[model samples]
Target: MIRTHQGINTDDDLKPDLTPLLDIIFIVMVFLLLTASVKLQSLDVDLPQTDTRTLQTTQADPITINLMSQSPYWALQGAAVEDWETFKTKLVEAVKAEPEKPVVIGADKTGSVENMLKLLAFLQQNNIKATQLLMEEEK
Candidate 1:
């Protein structure tokens, strides 16, 4: 009468209890949902007032300044300035003549950083704010 086989009950042993896992998953999901559903508070940001004039209208012709990689490391309008003193004097005069003109600076790839920084410092001291750096595109 005792014909119950214990070997046939392996299905129950092989089956793992997923109730705890499911409960943990549901709790995590509920937490995430609650956190996501919370109203986020943000302040009203002040928008900046931009200039209405176009570049062509305001900036007629940019004063191009080139920093060469060679001995004469400075050039204004394709003409190389002999020395730093000359370069500063010439640039100051040019800036004063056309204060609204934006200075476009283009540095040679092989140029030293020292020259570049010196030029920038000079421009800063002269209060030349409107400036642009020209970069050559790789061909």
Candidate 2:
């Protein structure tokens, strides 16, 4: 009689394969790429170079809000506001008054991210959708 020893192939003895996990990761990546919003962040608010301009429309000019951290100033349409709360209230009122009008944010490079985030949150909470970034010209 000959005795043969069989090798164990139990789950505890075998290592889990990573191929399925990699496949799942790839699938998630593809889904995100398909559903993600793609915007030009590098030039998000950068001013464009234009030579000729057409006549302006009757639509209300977008309100421009500038943020400066070093000096800590808030401006609405080139005029300075007293405080952030006031700025937020005025912004809300402006949007409420003219839902169709847009808000343009001119953020300084030295500004705090908190300020920008606050402004963004305010706009989002108010259901304002016509907000845009304003960048200065590169020189």
Candidate 3:
């Protein structure tokens, strides 16, 4: 047992002070409430507004670019492309024929990743953003 400066041992001296703890908790709660209230009050938020009426759907058919194992070059539909230059020309022609048409790449499993990447990079260079990968449907 420890004695106070007066040289008397008492249970009152050993009692935990809860007033400061409660005060801190109350202060924190008030601060949180104030912050929450401020957040709840809506300010002038300039959120990006999208116009659904302006959204147009493309009526053109999707262009399919198939990477065959027979040759490293891509085939536009069933038409054979001799080189990258020829493929790009054909792709541009197709895109011109039907603007805003999406391109679907049918990459062969046997084809190298490097070739596929080259094709993708070429497409990106051509500013073709809408592209879909063709996959065999599971039965």
Residue 86 accuracy (lDDT) in model 1: 95
Give one clash count per candidate, in the order shown: 0, 1, 0
The residue-level lDDT of candidate 3 at 114 comes to: 81
Order the numbered candidates by lDDT, best leading: 1, 3, 2
* lDDT agreement with native, every candidate: 0.69, 0.64, 0.65
User: Of the pair 1 and 3, which is ahead by lDDT?
Assistant: 1
Please list all clashing residue pairs in model 1, or write none if there are none: none
Candidate 3 local lDDT, 1-139, one digit each (tens): 8878998989887899999999999999998766443111111212223333443322235676777665645678656687878888988888778766667666676666787898889878878765556544432
Tens digits of per-residue lDDT for model 2, 1-139: 3333665445554668899999999999998777554332121232433343442222236666777665435767666777888888887887778777666677776677888788788778877774566543344
Q: How many backbone clashes does candidate 2 have?
A: 1
Model 1 whole-model lDDT (C-alpha atoms): 0.69
What TM-score, computed on C-alpha atoms, does each candidate reach?
A: 0.55, 0.52, 0.52
**Candidate 2 minimal-lDDT segment of 10 residues:** 38-47
* Candidates arranged by TM-score, highest first: 1, 2, 3
lDDT of 1 by residue, 1-139 (tens): 2233764545556678999999999999998766553221111212223344432222335787778777787888667888999998998998989887678776776787899899988888878974556543332
